[model samples]
Target chain A: GAGVSQSPSNKVTEKGKDVELRCDPISGHTALYWYRQSLGQGLEFLIYFQGNSAPDKSGLPSDRFSAERTGGSVSTLTIQRTQQEDSAVYLCASSSRGGVGADTQYFGPGTRLTVL
Target chain B: AQSVTQLDSQVPVFEEAPVELRCNYSSSVSVYLFWYVQYPNQGLQLLLKYLSGSTLVKGINGFEAEFNKSQTSFHLRKPSVHISDTAEYFCAVSAPGNTGFQKLVFGTGTRLLVSP
Candidate 1:
């Protein structure tokens, strides 16, 4: 079966530039999540989307970060006026259902975004 | 809020030797524990999960973990390791909310170095 996929495996942008990362969840998956992994650090939760419900934006660090899932399948994470602190690997994951203990999340290879 | 701790930043073991990665977590409510593995240049893959029932859970690639409620630990172990097992391992926890939406909190990660 096809796994979750992400675009732009590596992205380099200047500070103050805007960058967008894309994720394609597995078929039939109704839950998607976005996370960031900094160097020598664990993954940091960013946002979540489950079916038709309102997305979880509580984890967003600031107003510059936003995400949207179109048609409940693909998701795009946008960071406006990127900062050097935003340089990290952006990871995307999906599960068969939404909930805490519902299912295991399948992750994408991730997009490594570098802000110079 | 829940938080996970991977005590060891790195663990080096010889091929065919036993290995263990220590993980501990703290949460005020019931939680789901999971172990994930990330190979070089790859996304994370589910190694195992402990939701309920057996305290000892086995996962793919000959890995297992013991969930200890008293100590708040879910340590990953393998009898004999291979060079292929050299990768980063992460411990995560999630507390389900009333709406059935859960967010994962991850540990810093343990880097396993398997030498042949």
Candidate 2:
């Protein structure tokens, strides 16, 4: 039904400024993911989208992190200057299919991001 | 390039007295396994997956997981656990089929404290 959906459950940036986190998946789920859960990279895997773009950003960890998914669905993860270790808790997921070899993902209700 | 290793970040049981949450993965090929559960604040919810033909996979509340192909591992058990099963727990790996857009590889979460 209506499962995946992510927004500003919580965001408090400041370290360097620049923050944007959002996700909305589940309408048809075409594979979408972005993970981050502090406590020393306990939930890494930073970018993924199959309909809009993104082949596999390599779990992005450098370049301040980045993400995008427009027409196919909705996904955004921009952390530019922010750092304080980038805070934590930023998750989003969606799946119905994911071609390389795997499927079964459904998550949302995250966006802690607190880089004070 | 697939990897998943959730070797317990936290596990303190008591409620029922039988719990095991340990997942391991390192793809050489063929992949698709999952077990998601997040309670406090909410997000992930899969709880069970093995894809193939029974390797001992059962999920939802009662919990159960076992897909050990040569010991690649996909362990998540629950003989007697409650207290809402505490919280956090994730172990993912993907790359199967369809086009929904698969790309999952999570492991670095395990926080289940079911005390009495």
Candidate 3:
């Protein structure tokens, strides 16, 4: 079976520009998540979408960060007015029937974004 | 809220040598623990998890973690690590809320360097 995958393995942009990172979760995964990995902040959760419930955006650092899962499968994370602090590897993960204590999350290759 | 702490930022070991990566967490309520590994230029993958039933959880790539509730620790250990095992290890915790939403809180990660 195919695992989770992301597009644009690498992206470099200037400050104040906009960048979009995409993620495709495994088939039949009802729960999807976005995370950011950086030298300063480590790994931080960005957003979460489970089934049809409202997406959890609590982990989003700022208002400039937003994400949407279309048709409950693919998710896109958009960072507007990118800053140098936004330079990091954006990771995506998915799990089957999330919220369970033992559910395992499969991760994608990740999209490395560099904001100059 | 749950948080994970990995005190060791880096660990270097020789091939076929035993190694231990310490991890401690703080949480008011019961929590789920997990260990993940990330190779260079790749996404993170699950190493092991401790949800219930047993305190000792085994994972892939010859890795295992022991969850201790009294000490609030879940440390990863391997009897003899190989060169291929060199990677970054992360300890994470999650406490499901009333809505059963699980958001992982990860540590800063420990970079393990294996020398042959």
Top lDDT hit: 1
Residue A84 local lDDT, model 1: 94
Please give the lDDT score at residue B46 for candidate 3.
92
Candidate 1 per-residue lDDT, tens place, B51-107, comes to 999999999999999999999999999999999999999999986544557888899
Residue lDDT tens for model 2, B8-70: 789998998998998999987878898888899878888888878889988888999989989
**How should the candidates be ordered by TM-score, best one leading?**
1, 3, 2
Predicted structure 2, TM vs. truth: 0.34
RMSD of candidates 1 onward, in order: 1.4, 13.9, 1.4
> How do the candidates rank by lDDT, highest first?
1, 3, 2
lDDT of 2: 0.82
Question: Where is model 1 more than 4 Å wrong at Cα?
Answer: B97-100
Tens-place lDDT digits, model 2, residues A1-107 = 58888889998978989999989999877778788878876777677777897777777888888888988898888889998988889888878765544467778
Question: How badly does each model clash, as a count of residue pairs?
Answer: 0, 9, 0
Proportion of native contacts kept per candidate = 0.73, 0.68, 0.70
Off by over 4 Å in 3: B97-99
